[model samples]
Target chain A: MIHWPVPEPEIPAGTHPALAAVARAAVAAFRDARGRFDRTQLAEKVDMGADGTPTTRLDQLVDTAVAETVDAHRVNLISEEIGVIDNGSAVTLVVDPVDGTSNAVAGVPFSAFAGVVAVDGEAVESLTTWLDTGRSWHAKAGETLPYRTTGRRELDGAAVSLLRPHPKSEDAWLRVSRRAGRVRVLSSSCLEAALVAEGSLDAFADPGSDTHRIMDIAAAAVLLPAAGGALIDAYGRPVEIDPDLSRRWSGIAAATPDLAEELAEEINRPSS
Target chain B: MIHWPVPEPEIPAGTHPALAAVARAAVAAFRDARGRFDRTQLAEKVDMGADGTPTTRLDQLVDTAVAETVDAHRVNLISEEIGVIDNGSAVTLVVDPVDGTSNAVAGVPFSAFAGVVAVDGEAVESLTTWLDTGRSWHAKAGETLPYRTTGRRELDGAAVSLLRPHPKSEDAWLRVSRRAGRVRVLSSSCLEAALVAEGSLDAFADPGSDTHRIMDIAAAAVLLPAAGGALIDAYGRPVEIDPDLSRRWSGIAAATPDLAEELAEEINRPSS
Candidate 1:
């Protein structure tokens, strides 16, 4: 409903049209591959990762094809399957060849997304696409990005849904439903987190939320922050991009930093 | 996804093709009107009701137009604005001209729908639809109904989209993100709730829920239950159909009974 005007900014002057074309082609290829496969077919194509996460042959195939096309762009890459591959450049292209693996595997139309975050070392600019539905959103230094937040957007009291319903899932839903917003549940943490960034949602929390591998949050790291959002780990640390996603971090709480901190305190607070 | 098979039952011997055609035409006309008018335009067209609920001239116009066409069918009418006008018949027809009035007036695409639930005044059957996007879902006694649920065939722990975000709006997003298969705020409580029965969503809940009248759930009453789903009041009571939809109910929770109850309990429990 908020038709905020979008502002454009100048980018590094270079012909990245080829990269863009390759990106489009990769997206088309992925969608085509998926269009041919259903949930049962997807399950057959997936394998368990070393991190106990599910990875599909399609995931690997798509990532490889995209990497092959974008490799010549000379941008350093940080991907989900393969770790960081440096191209001797200061700018890193953080990519998630696919975000909603489970939805894809389940044949849910909500799946299919590819994200690109241009990172200048610590600084990042995020671009995300909901490939299945083709809803694209991005935010860089120059544009007044698609996702922005209004802090202090509190619970008006309603039901809630959580990814890894905490030990206090029951209590959490109850507390929020009464005062904040009501809870509901959905899969695809990345998409949900993006909703939080877009101000369409108030928060996204997960306990035992080890599902997010490097590829998932790589895009989110750039997207959330640029959109006035923050992400926190379960132990209450700032959820950073684990370049070597071989190890699992605690969990995630993505929203405004203040609210994220408050929620962390509330969830971790001693039960009265 | 639980494929609740609901093979089409026998359409009564004298089901009129003309009647069905007229209903479909009315639905198309209403959709066109709503499409051309954005949210601001819709707000101007509506008249506020005494119970703090708002009604639109379009709503009445659509209802009357549909009813007038179906008048010769010798069926009792239970509708939104006009309540019930009994010509004294064993069979009843429930109609909702527009379900998501708020979203319709807000320029959100989460509105637009027409449904019919025909019953013998006892058990219900036949849930036919023309939904927000002009897509239709028809369910009868014997048909392979498409829907999904975790474990049991219900809307529990499923992606939930609510019209009003509980606790704070953020928590609604969080709850759906964490618990349900996915989280969506589609804006139309009626369509969203109907999707629960159709298995498009795990469930639909509205604690601060309103904007639904009898006609809203009439078609759903037949389809959801026929598809093995249920829609209940806040107190977990069956929604009664008055000959006239003079009084508005509190809100609706449509899902598998188990999922609906679990969510409702969590939502209504006293917060510490």
Candidate 2:
């Protein structure tokens, strides 16, 4: 069993009530699940998710709690496992209940609770909580973040985080890894994007894999720009709020617009 | 500054008193350093280490604290920064004061304090503490660890952690990554080794990158064997406690001897 306890996220005062509730629910549910189940049980595939992928037991447990919290708050939720819950309300919560389910279930302590508040199909604010340490990053559209990025305009000599290499994107992954001064595969996209926002990392990308769903990049869309960074797709597609969970993109988040653009161009270069 | 607090390590009972003191000293020094220095200041290169590499201020501060603790306990010391502290005693503490200094300085929270108690040039016990969370693992040689390994015999479907891809070792890195069921580059060797001991990961390897010094893999030398696992050098060299800091090894720690051998063989394969 993972004997480590999950701490409460350091959410700021003015966060949306619904977002705060969902974050709390996720933290509590995750803590309870870790306390009860061992690694194998927590990671066992329980059912299919809304994203057309297998869901781990830990994901299901946390999603159940998040669902109940969203219901009680009378808000709609577009999430990884639960798919869509439209209550005919203007306010919607886009969430990745467990951003790194594998890490969480394996007792690696690098998963996160990421959510964005969208109104009229437009994201207005976001929050990401590192479940292991309760460190959080919160931001709203059009407003400057309390923290800032490194303002790096190029990928050379920059510290970057990336997804695990897929066969399809192996060459693209290697290209980025070769150019960057330091490379990491933390396996938690949300937490990685938060690091980029806080100036800890210069950038984070999916290379050319196109593996990210809306829920995976939604909070980052709202967080990055406000933190003096830019968010785009590796293939020049827009990262927007969508109820459809099947659509995927290779999200590229970086410290500056130039860096994001340069990453997209580099990742799209022909594989050697 | 990294706004997170470093908690006290939960060192198990019956650990060597000198080892525990060094752990405490390292923790306190790390907390103090993080509290005072910003990321840039903390990560700044302070001096060249005894290992013939640049040392960060964070490493230097923590190493100084550990050195003092070793002196107070009247034991010799072999570490990254301060090199060999020959008190002329039979007891020596082999330590990596900050195993993941880059991660720690950048607020990634994946760094560790790893140490081993060596008597007459043989490691007898080990302790590894996650400096961010204070969670620790302690084990003695020739005694079974209460928490055992996964006992995985093959790398076909094993969960593996690796160091980041280096230029000369990229092909070898991909070979291991492609064959594994799950791949991670957490960039913290000591913490990754601890994960293997706790069964959270099946194995961790350097993938033909001869980047590991004695302090980097010393604790795992004692921990893995006691946890029903094996530790081997990727090039078939013996991993022993040596005072020569310039020497390097590609360390492979696995859940079983068979897995360790398979990893070494795979890593040594010719590049594709």
Candidate 3:
């Protein structure tokens, strides 16, 4: 065993009970929907969305269902399909009713993550969410109680899970894939990247065209950095989580700053 | 939901208790050792094998432990680290103590498979084994029941999982990854191929080098074909499994014969 020294970082304290509650409810909703969706008997009861994404009648129903239930708590909603719903409050709630629409439609068991990012104009804090498996990973802005794994701490030893391989960047794919101790392309990029924040994985890379929205990585943005990990744009720059819900960005997330830097440097290396 | 009209094919039988028994014991030992190895407080407690592969003291202990347990059943053993051990019978047991050694050492969850292709010198009879999570998949020759999947019935919309991007293969990766409704690379070729057999995934491909051995795909050979899938080499040729455990090969497994043909043609495309 090639042992490496790792500093166990702490989870922050801003993870509110309200955020955790919403995250749990979101996960349960997704899990229940997933089981029903996978049953051979009920494969086609859903409808298609405007973006050409699969949105089942169940999906819309679940979206509205989550919206209504969370609205009861009077938290402002920033969602994937639907944009933001402001209730004249400082704390904004961001949600992806179903993050991995494609996978969820196809019966892959991943996660439905919901995050609450308390923002006062430009400053942000905290994220908490649960997955379909009833397992939750959360971290406050500066606390010490969340995901941590024991292993060699090289970004190379990390499982860099991607949604799809880089098409225009074959050389980049080879570099990342070779360095990644193991590469997994789990369909759900949202959950895949969140695993990095939870320390279940060392890093997560998207590096696709800038089509991945903030809603896709918003909860992850809040969750990862709070856990001592960082999410950076494809250019290896920090991703600014503006109030804009539709702002799309391509990037990577690392469990540690050192890993984020290492991966960024390697992935950003000039393709020979 | 792009539903295609098709009748389900006859499911093949893959019931082989003795082979299944050996596989089960080996997988269980590896998994238990793996779990302990993951939590081992000391780093050097693990053993690195001569093949540049990882073997924990737990792995060695488990391999021996599993072999001795199988010895009680009076079957010969052929494993990765240790060469073939005779048991005074014509029967030989082919085993890969751990299929994805790199993945295992890195704590990546993938299957550790075993195959017992009962052969009388040159004639083959049956095979069976367990996957990463301990799910049993197997089949016997001339048996009608092979582990099969329902998803592969819809060829047009079926999901195909690959181990890595096609390596030097023409449009094989592109055609498959884009054509399939969903594509994933879970890193474990054996388990991914096994899942194809079990119908969890519609198809699987590992276009890597010939590092994948007969032992790696032996259990899959029994499981996939019995489950209505086809396994072939990277060149898309038939993968012949010899009774001797010394051989290794590279290949792909598809849920349907049509898919296998499609993949082969695509990979052989001149521009690809």
For every candidate structure, what is the RMSD over all alpha carbons to the true structure, in angstroms? Answer: 8.9, 1.2, 8.2
Instruction: Output the lDDT of residue A171, model 2.
Output: 91
Candidates 1 and 2 compared by lDDT, better number: 2
User: Please, what are the lDDT tens digits per residue for candidate 1 over residues B81-123?
Assistant: 5556576767666655566654443332345454454556542
Better of 1 and 2 by TM-score: 2
Better of 2 and 3 by lDDT: 2
In candidate 3, residue B15 scores what lDDT? 36
How far residue B183's Cα lies from its native spot in candidate 3, in Å, is: 3.3
Query: Lowest lDDT 10-mer window, candidate 3 chain B?
Result: B1-10
- Alpha carbon lDDT of residue A35, candidate 2? 93
Tell me the DockQ of each model, to 2 decimals.
0.15, 0.78, 0.31
| Superposition TM-score, candidate 1 onto the true structure | 0.63
Error of 2 at B75 (Å): 0.5
Please list the residue runs of candidate 2 whose C-alpha ends up more than 4 Å from where it truly belongs after superposition: none
Q: What is candidate 2's lDDT per residue for A179-269, written digit by digit as tens?
A: 9988989889988999999988899999989899998899899999999998999999888888888899999889999999999999999
Docking model 2 quality class: medium
For candidate 3, write residues B169-209 as lDDT tens digits. Answer: 32456666656777787666666776666556677766444
After aligning candidate 3 to the native by TM-score, how far in Å is the CA of A144 from where it should be?
2.3
Q: Estimate each model's TM-score.
A: 0.63, 0.98, 0.78
Every candidate's lDDT: 0.52, 0.92, 0.57
Task: Give TM-scores of the second chain, every candidate.
Answer: 0.72, 0.99, 0.73
